[model samples]
Target: MSKIVMFDMDGTLLDLSFDDFIWNECLPERHAKIHQLPLSESKEKLYQFYQSHRHTLVWYSSTYWTKTVGVDVLKLQQEFQSKIQARSGCIELLQQLKEQGYICWLVTNADRASLRLKLDNIAIEHFFDVIISSEQVGYAKEDINFWQELQRLHPFNPDETIFIDDTATVLKTAEKFGIQHLFNISQPSSLKDIKQHQDLEFKTLDRLTELLSILNEIDRKDNDVKIA
Candidate 1:
């Protein structure tokens, strides 16, 4: 039987430093400039908004943010499109998965516009068998309905699936939905400190290619069980 691997786009397959720059630095500066407020004040206000909408669909929507924050968030991201980059060993892992005949899916909470922007900059789209945005599902990945909708759209055995994401909340949702193998990224952003595995709910991978060895080990264990 073939196994399916589901990956969160940003912070999993891609270096999240670009997103960190856009949200934490660029957006606040732009917001402050537009509102003629102090940078500190703007950051505090935006941080409050972020906290309120963190795992919601609106939180991931560029249009919603553009209107609420009075800045064109999508346009801002495009301005720094050059900074968008895949994580180290990202392509190598995808290529190996494709060659090895494992089905690959990109499951991201990024709204359609943001998803398009990232795909336009990175050349990893062709590697995925299916690419889904939470916007299309009408629910954020933190919501169980997103998984239900995803399964409805493209049927796959939950027990045969592996999910990798950087967010603990998203991983917990997937776990609740019964995906068998759940993994987290230790260092999602090149700009941030590495997350300790003890802090994460699932196994944390420091390198993208480490997944290949993990998959091999899982296969080995399954074969041993079958032979026994």
Candidate 2:
């Protein structure tokens, strides 16, 4: 069996702009109908509410829907799922990796609820062998406990568990946790404007069709190899 590779969804595979589109357009378009508010007002309220809780568990998963959205949780999730999904080539990317004999898992900082919504919308929920969420462990990617929990669940040699993300902070933390391979999205860093330790990076994932080639280049190189 090929080694396991972990993927970060939002800024890594899913188009980043799709986030703004969903929160700003698709979601509010549905929300306004349910709440009987003006579309503009609903959009503004949702945006403001999200800004305050973007990094929390409530924002990431169904907790927010059950407690705050005032509707059937599953129904609201189905509604949201109908809105945004993975970007073009997302399924193809995973399929290609699977065909290449790699075990692919979605490792994200997103709360379970939010992540499930996105995955269901894409209808590729089965692509991952596991969906690791920081919410379950009570620590975001910034904390190594999340990684420790993941390691306990599925032990992968650090030199083998590849992490692809768009955030430099998580990239650094993953590196520290001993994940040997880390690739920053070939785009502007979304989490923070910071330098990275990895030499391999991408600009924009217009064609993750290139991943196969990149994987071959991993060289199974030892951890001592520094960023070129």
TM-score of each: 0.98, 0.69
After superposition, which runs of candidate 2 have C-alpha atoms over 4 Å from their true positions?
25-59, 65-77, 187-206, 220-228
TM-score of 2: 0.69
Give the true-structure RMSD of model 1: 0.8
> All candidates' lDDT scores?
0.96, 0.69
51-138, model 2: which lDDT tens digit per residue? 7876454665556654665444545445645545465567888888888788988888766767766775677667788888888777
Off by over 4 Å in 1: none
Model 2 clash pairs?
60-114, 61-113, 61-114, 186-202, 186-203, 186-204, 187-203
Number of the top candidate by lDDT? 1
Error of 1 at 63 (Å): 0.6
State the number of backbone clashes in model 2: 7
